[model samples]
Target: MKVDGEVTTGLGKAAYFLSQEFYTKEFEKNLGFIPYPGTLNVIVSDEYLDEINEIKCNCENLIKPDEGFGAVRYIEAKLNDVIVGAIVFPAKTTHDENYLEFIAECKLRDELDLKDGDIVSLEF
Candidate 1:
């Protein structure tokens, strides 16, 4: 499926490959398995287009996955410096399943104002 959004910083060939590899490894480490082999579609939002552009221009690099199954495709949208919203592409076969869980977790985190190093475990 084609996911359409605003144009953010265009990723280079090497960056794209590295990002894919990093996500693959992170998924295995976190879930004790690899994602279902499939081509995942990522859409970058226009809201963070300028920020992404600035980062690329200055650093010549994009933010990579942070040692997890979920990776930010593009900032999607932001409120101030905080990432209020984003589009994450997981290698899982069903994107909705992962997305729903993400939303639920975000809600809980927001409700409790959870901080870094706090672990939230879900039974699935």
Candidate 2:
């Protein structure tokens, strides 16, 4: 599946969660790299919202979190056909259907030079 969206600022919470050893270990084990201690947030284009939601419903690969945290499901993805990563969605996420949260081995914003409103595509 391919999803396109504009980069956006997140709530600044992923750094804390991604920094947790339990989650980082799982990310390294399941996604193949220790994720940078943050996520790159995207708001799916209106044209792809429904498609992303459908994909979300069918997704199965998950990283179970410790007590008090929500399970996260991910799909392997390539950002802009360059950097490899995963699109993650927490079971208890506050985001709606339009949001896509990505994690990778490096901080995506710095690695990709991304900023709010920049358009990017993810292929999974």
For lDDT, the strongest prediction is 2
lDDT of 1 by residue, 23-59 (tens): 5564445434433332222333455456544542444
- Alpha carbon lDDT of each predicted model: 0.33, 0.87
Please list all clashing residue pairs in model 1, or write none if there are none.
Answer: none
Per-residue CA lDDT of model 2 for 44-108, tens digit only, reads 76888777777878998887888998888888899999999999888887777788899899988
Clashes of each: 0, 0
TM-score of 2: 0.93
Global local distance difference test of model 2:
0.87
Model 1 alpha-carbon drift over 4 Å, by segment = 1-19, 39-124
Residue 119 lDDT in model 1?
A: 34
TM agreement with the true structure for every prediction:
0.22, 0.93
Error of 1 at 97 (Å): 12
Q: Pick the candidate with the highest TM-score.
A: 2
**Candidate 1 total steric clashes:** 0
